[model samples]
Target: MLTVNKTDLVRHHVPVTMADRFAFRLVGGLSTVASVLFSKRYGNRAVVLETVAAVPAMVSATLLHLRCLRRMVDDHGWIRTLMVEAENQRAHLMSFVAIARPSGWQRFLIVLAQGAFYNSYFLLHLLSPRTAYRVAGYMSEQAIQGYTRYLEDLESGVQTDIEAPAFAIDYWHLSPQAKISEMLVSMRADEAIHRDIQHAFADALVAGKLLPDLPATDLDAGSSIGLDEKRLDAS
Candidate 1:
């Protein structure tokens, strides 16, 4: 995994177009709702947020695959990039699940929220992929902010700095004695990459580009951490 510099942790995309404004407002509304529901319970919030976060990449990859097939053109690596992103997000969800140990009702809420978000995002992507990507980028920015606050709480002794989950340590190549604060730092780096990639995709679409290169984050080369199917299922 690439090391995340201070600049990477604080990046944000400015909204200019009407579509960009729409995405900004939409993410803001969702963030408000998340705050209302979870308050400062960042662990539980992460479980639900990561569950929903895993959806858009899979949806984009599926649609792009179909589009490539229909047009008889190569995807230029976008499919694999999106699939890796989905896998990374899934790893995040599973790690948080271990940390949070969510209740049965919370799990049910996750299911409902995931289904609702998947359908809504699928429709949005179909209608306007550029705007959809912008929404994703903005959502990731919000995730970075949330994780930063979570880290602050951990560091300030507001939230307990628990030992990192075993799966998290293995997945992120973290030290055996790592704590949840370290895991959050790693996860925040992942979110920073996601934010950049999503905005890059949106910018490419807006520019009428056929093949958009992945950002210098180098996540497309598998620099980001991921878990295999068997390992994920075991976790």
Candidate 2:
């Protein structure tokens, strides 16, 4: 289980080095460009964008797990947050999988993208966790933008508003008859939460005052993934 002082979170986060700041900014820039190109290539970019959304969290969690193992100390709340984020994004990807019904080539593209992203993100986190986190924050911004556009399409009748997936309804506590726009709203909220967390983690890293040794129990009891099992059940 993870623990946090919500009070501090609002004001405190990792403070970053110049190099890390630059690297993170560069990634954010590239992400913006990618979002544009992806939308141009695909009708809706949510499926592919959300597929890669889980990358940073998974990468961070793996590293934090190993760090915890080697040092035999608490990883603050980073592990739980990262893992929860990964699971939440997985849900987003899952819902979109059913709705988007990606083509075979798109599916293969997912595999390739995940493989490349996972390795690249892992190395980046290893070299500089701060920058890696910033990258995730940027990626979440991209996700939000894509989902917003999808919602716009639905509202404008460019695309029909479809019934929300059962999993989305149950997991989100959305109206049983909720539609895709409602689901997208819930998802965007989740992305905003992650975006904040990523920035905070980056700030914590910069502050150099974030980590403190802890007892054996994990510090991740609270996370957005609290809804994950229910979402899975609906699936």
Candidate 3:
């Protein structure tokens, strides 16, 4: 089970380079577009966003795998780490799909968005993996904020705190009586972990390190690399 530190939920990466700035602005633009499209419909928003969120990890893993093959060198466990992240994001999508029950038009929009984002991110990764990771980092930050809003709505009775889907319960090992608010909290923590990992990858790239010595936060443990402490102290 994943244990989320409250500090991780509020951690933010301060942009330093032009690439980081561009990535931050890019995600901000997308967040605005999502807000205009979804408004207060957080469930539907999650379904669409999770579909796009699941892309970068798989793309990065594929490209890195091929790069390692070509160079006959080790990937230093990055391939598995990215693959796990991809699977985790996919699980999030499944959980939200069950809860949101998106309509046909929303489903169609999901396909279009996923297709466009996948291809664009693929090309961006080819050109600059550092910026690609930075974009993902900022995007995860947006997701955290979105989920936080959802939690607030649930708490304030603006949205009903419905029972969590069975899939989410099983995936997260939640209690049978878990509410959607609880699920949102777990998902928010997952997004925080993604945010930290992506920013760490971008930082490693900026420092000219091929692979960073991150903490061993494997799929089973559901732990993060603990970047928040250092970042918070620095801030």
Residues 1-235 of candidate 3 have per-residue lDDT tens digits of: 3356767788899888999899999999988888889886888888898999999989988988998899888876777777777888898899998988999999999999999999999999999999999999999999988888888888999999999999988877788999998778777877887887788888888889866665655433333243212121110
lDDT of 1 at 57: 84
The TM-score of candidate 2 is 0.77
CA RMSD (A), model 3 = 4.5
CA-lDDT, candidates in order: 0.82, 0.68, 0.82
Clashing pairs in 3: none
Model 1 agreement with the true structure over 18-89: per-residue lDDT tens digits: 999999999899888878888858788889889999988888889889988998998767778778888888
Off by over 4 Å in 2: 1-44, 210-235
Candidate 2 local lDDT, 1-235, one digit each (tens): 1222323223323335675567557656656755675655333356776777888888878877897889787767767767888888888877777676778877787788778878888888889887887788767766666666777788899888889888878777788899988887777667766776777667667777444233354345553433333321110
Name the better of 2 and 3 by TM-score. Answer: 3
Return the TM-score for candidate 3, rounded to 2 decimals.
0.90
